[model samples]
Target: MKRKHPELYEILVKTYQQDISESFKVDFKALMGKLKERVGRNSPCPCASGKKFKKCCLRK
Candidate 1:
């Protein structure tokens, strides 16, 4: 999988790490806004595509 979308994955993973590491900051509005722009939105699907959260593998 490293051969596919390496740069995007790298940046996204790093951003997520940063996000999780800041869990106790008492404020997440700003951080969440930025993450939303970068990662898009997430919604549940009943089709059971069994993919990662942001992948939308269940969209089909």
Candidate 2:
């Protein structure tokens, strides 16, 4: 997974830990939106697919 989507892996680990609060749901959505905005179409899919996000799991 790391080899396929290093950026997403890094962010996921940095964002979520052992325990999260209920309020984190809001924060999580914001964080994910920010991430999607920050990532490029050429970036590897967060799902670990070796294809670009536009050609892989990204919703049309």
Candidate 3:
């Protein structure tokens, strides 16, 4: 929810869109999965670093 962290989520969502692209026009679950696998790594706080949710910040 960018409403909470407008600045951070704004950048994050932007980065997410750049990486996802138009091909991500699939289901919500699948899209979310890809997003986590892509930008949810380095982001330890929100774990949205373009990496797999399991292997992302979720681990550490």
Task: In model 3, state the lDDT of residue 33.
Answer: 58
Q: Which candidate number has the best TM-score? A: 2
By lDDT, who's the top model here? 2
Per residue, candidate 3 scores C-alpha lDDT tens digits across 1-60 of: 768889999888778778555765445454455554454334443333555555644543
Q: Mark the regions of model 2 whose C-alpha exceeds 4 Å error after superposition.
A: 1-37
- Worst lDDT 10-window in candidate 1: 39-48
Q: 54, model 3: CA deviation in Å?
A: 40
- TM-score, every prediction: 0.28, 0.35, 0.27
- Per-residue alpha-carbon lDDT of model 2 for 1-60, expressed as tens digits? 889999999988888774666555344344446564566778986555588887865663
lDDT of 3 at 12: 86
For 1-60, candidate 1 gives per-residue lDDT tens digits of 557989988988888777564565433344334443343236432223454435643232
For the record, the alpha-carbon RMSD of candidate 1 to the native fold, in angstroms, is: 15.9
Candidates ranked, most accurate by TM-score first: 2, 1, 3
lDDT of 1 at 18: 78
lDDT of the candidates, in the order given: 0.49, 0.67, 0.55
